[model samples]
Target: MSHPSMDDMNLNAPHSMGTTIIGVTYDGGVVLGADSRTSTGVYVANRCSDKITQLTDNVYVCRSGSAADSQVVSDYVRHFLHQHTIQLGQPATVKVAANLIRLLSYGNKNMLQTGLIVGGWDKYEGGKIYGVPLGGTVIEAPFAIGGSGSSYLYGFFDQAWREGMTKDEAEKLVVKAVSLAIARDGASGGVVRTVVINSEGVKRNFYAGDTLPLWHEELEPQNSLLDILAAGGDGPAPMNE
Candidate 1:
């Protein structure tokens, strides 16, 4: 059998999607983070895409995989959860929403190719994190992550993740994990964006790329590439809003 070439691979699977998204459950609530850069294969598609979305006043969802698929599934879950809450006068919990996604994906034969983590605080559950990947499998874990950027996470998360962390500790851990992932993953860059779900409700925050430590700031270029292209261009600076 002949192996496929890069050209064939790109042609046969013409979509490019990249991201780093994580969800963590701590003592009081759940924390979620996602990178802002949207990529298609090796090319950057958008620099300002928000992978973490508000599902409700207390619930948040982070998506990774095909942008279109993630968008549609997340929207569907959001709408479904919203209507369910309004109808019953009760907010949905992280597990409820995760299982809902699992149901929808299973019915669709898990065609979306998306990995999602639903995080939130529920009056009944306090704090929770749910992971759903392709195939409708729903996992209730203390922490969960997804995307190509996850390739760099094996050892990183094992060391960084811990239970009973305070809100502050969880937030900083999120920042560190995302920062390291961005530094190493060529397809995952741009500023790190996050959402925190607690009793106060879901709140979003961000870390501009410039605000993060430049791991390569001390490396001297063998010759110079910055001098050849755009003299002063640092190439894709972080955006502020």
Candidate 2:
């Protein structure tokens, strides 16, 4: 058997979003959230790549998996949706957008590598969330999560997700979930970004890393090392810790 060359392996490696993306429905609207890490194998290609993509005025998608595949899917979906809206003379509903994604994902399952969560508010349905995972399966969910960090979050969501939550509560949950995942999952990191869509309009929020709540050992002080080092003298220049 001929072993693959290093160049062959490098060329075939996909740029992936080993991510934490979420779609949550609240009392009045839906919120989509995601971490911003894009990686190629073990190397981080982009520290802050926006995984949440806007599909229309209200509809948005949280993309996870091969970055290129997800981007191309989103782009195609966006164009199709634009035509859909023009023909209908109204904004496309959340279901329409999700189904389009499902069609593309499923039809090209053999060639594509991506999992998407679609979330938005429609005049008819009020608020909705859909999970389109690998192989083109579409599942409507109250709240949907995907990507590498999702394994760590299944239990967390079971305990934390509830019906009729207020908008603020849902947003808080998303931020907290991403932060917890960041602490545990090596592939998910960077800031958290969220999109809220409702009867009124769409709103976007950005949370910096420093502002997020620390979890587990992250909350513990590293004072032991710093204090020991400082014990001798002036202490390296009083590091940030």
Candidate 3:
């Protein structure tokens, strides 16, 4: 009987570091999304890793760059947030979470390896989106994005994104931006995963070209820009996103 080496196991692990993550604060809430592709060099590592993750019932994070680094830091920040809630008798806010991420990656920013979009609703601040980029820089923006696919977002956002968008409208914009990236960027593929934060709290969603977007089963990308545009500019499905 032969056994796989550690490198082989590592290669098989699901940590799609190469991705596109977007966060936007709309009229009364926030929406965050990511493509589910993890790649290493020329090979795709995993397609099903959840890049957009729940932090508090109200706060969530979208990760890009160094998969292991982001995952571990987010886990640490999660624990800290929970502990804060326990000690303070209230849930942690987006600002607090963003600060923690900043502190963790600060000073070591050059060596540290991740960029994050922290989005959530707060009692005092209302809907918020904070960017904790590499080098410990914390930027609060109405809309922000990161990762390999972010470069493709500039034009679409410049043309399509606007202020005071409703949640449904925000979702459409996110899906459209990600679809365009997946079509052009080889590093980003797989199903698009999303999370929304509002007065009611967090809403999680999944988007794809097919009704069932299962990465492990399909082992390939579902829709390209051409695939979506070819199907038509608008469709009843998430393809129109």
Candidate 4:
């Protein structure tokens, strides 16, 4: 039997789908999380996909969509960052990274498609995180979720994220967000990959199935909207309207 080349891998496989979630802390830092599942069609081919990567001492990246595509994109970004730093005599900026990704995606538009989240602090800009799609659109947000399970993760982030959450809070949210995504999205499962980028540096950890922490306690289901309205008791809409 002969092994297949890189070109032989099917980029359109259902299991190839990936998702990532990133949260920016109030004090100017970021936390990112991704699942460790790679699939072929409807079947899971690998359960430990490493989708989070470091581009520089200060910069980190999380990506999703087409494992092969992501690998290529990540490698290119890392290389570009390093080369750009040497050429410009400074650390690569978010704009530079985004532009590099845009150029690469444009060249291999047919073979690869990747969504990247770049986060870190800049000398002049303080802390920042930008999500860049394959089509070159870049946007900033306090928190951003991408990939198949993004919807579920976004819901968790939207409600739990606050203006000044601490590093610990950010870490907990990353774990909870990825766990929720895994539960709701079939293509996302297995271990959870967590990465923290702060003023000091970037730290990464992996949580396997048994080691993963419980996000929210198992609660008896209830009507949340009705409960909220009941709690408010129709009190003049709480002003500031």
Candidate 5:
């Protein structure tokens, strides 16, 4: 019997990436978050970036580093999952997804540099989160944050994450973690893109503008020098001022 061709196997071309991506797990499901900023070295190339991507009905993928490279890895993973489901007659599990990434990286070891986070419910593991580094190494954690802010966000997650936490609580922690990362990491800024993966599928939400707590609400009322000058403030101002 002749085996199906690659295309006949349901695999397609890969996609690329652009920015920072993170993930965390909770009781009901897992949450993936990413910054909407794309940069190379110190130069910011784009502001409205989105790393979080929906791979399947309930599976989600995100990545960081070389926007172009990351996108390819993500697209490849998505295609692999679809093909696996078609060929195996079942949804791709976290382990399979992780292994596929590793194999791809091994195939092009020196040429690829992309960190990824794959999160969703596994048929056997229930809720699962896997962080795959550039070389396809896999790591499991209650929470995982990738990209330039990986270290900073991991610190926050380490402090906030707890076993048996509810999905809502985990979501809040993820937001906080991303907010902190954006504040500290220059390449990781802009809006926070979050996705929740569960039995109900993936739910995406975007928190744009000055929504993160890093912005000071009280400082909003502070008067600018222009405003003060416009008021003709000279010499000694009033005691109230």
Candidate 6:
């Protein structure tokens, strides 16, 4: 009997998740968002996977990279935070949950293939956003973006993100950014999901693919090469055509 090589086995694994995840802090709280596509090789394994995970009643995480790795990290952090909350007789802070993820990610950096953004509201800090990147580095920022799609968004965020944005504005920015990523990044698509947390509570929102406004090339008319050829050498067909 012949057996498959390690490379063949690895190629068949379906837990990879190339994605777009965002975290933005507003005056009152924070908004965490993610795209819903989980890919395996060039195949889309799941079109509507939930990448945002709840770490606590007030804290949520935007997961990227390998879906299995991120899910396990979130599970470990959630378990630890639950114990910590029981010991302290109060909810765990956003920093605590983020640090827990950072520690786990860093400790197993070589074995783990995931990056995460942690966002939440707490009594002490009000609203907070933290980035736990692939190497286990943790950075607190007013706004953060990650995953494959983030490569297309640095300039946009710099131009669009602002301080003291209201809750609505922050949520709008998150949704808009995720939609933009979905348009440009082949690895990012499906729907957009967001978690908004603040002193009031946590709110979840979902935006379907058909509902998101198209942008740039997406807004252009769909014309195939065959259509151009069929135009009888008219150079190019009009967009409306």
Model 3 / residue 166 / CA error / Å: 0.5
Tell me the tens digit of each residue's lDDT in model 1 across 120-163.
89998888898887777889999998887888986888998888
* lDDT at position 15, candidate 4: 48
Worst 10 residues of 1 by lDDT: 218-227
Estimate, for each residue in 68-135, the C-alpha lDDT of model 6 and write its tens digit: 89999999999999999999999999999999999999999999999999999999999999999999
> Model 4 over residues 1-241: C-alpha lDDT tens digits?
9976545765445547555545465566777778888778666787787777777777777878877777778787898789889998988776576567777876777776777777776666656777876665677887777888886766567778887777788878888778777767777877888877776777888887556654555333334465478887554465675
lDDT of 2 at 100: 100
Clashing pairs in 1: 16-40, 16-41
Query: Which is the better candidate, 1 or 5, if ranked by TM-score?
Result: 1
Candidate 1, after superposition: displacement of residue 129 in Å? 0.5
Error of 3 at 171 (Å): 0.7
- Residue-level lDDT tens digits of model 5 in 1-241: 9977766633342332334577888888888888888764444556667788777666777877766777787788788889889998888877677677778766776998788788888768877888877776788766777787776655556677888888788778777777777777666777888898887777888887377785432232234476578898763565883
- Quick one: how many clashes does candidate 3 have? 3
Query: Whole-model lDDT, candidate 6?
Result: 0.91
Which is superior by lDDT, 3 or 6? 6
In model 6, the worst 10-residue window by lDDT is: 219-228
Model 3: what TM-score?
0.81
In model 3, the clashing pairs are 16-38, 175-241, 176-241
Question: Could you tell me the C-alpha RMSD of candidate 4 in Å?
Answer: 15.3
Identify the leading candidate in terms of lDDT.
2
Q: How accurate locally, in lDDT, is each candidate?
A: 0.80, 0.92, 0.83, 0.73, 0.73, 0.91
Better of 3 and 4 by TM-score: 3
- The C-alpha stretches of model 1 lying farther than 4 A from their native spots are 1-15, 216-241
Clashing pairs in 4: 15-39
Error of 5 at 207 (Å): 0.7
Q: TM-score, each model?
A: 0.83, 0.86, 0.81, 0.77, 0.78, 0.86
Candidate 2 per-residue C-alpha lDDT over 65-179 given as tens digits, one digit per residue, 9 for 90 to 100: 9999999999999999999999999999999999999999999999999999999999999999999999999999999999999999999999999999999999999999999
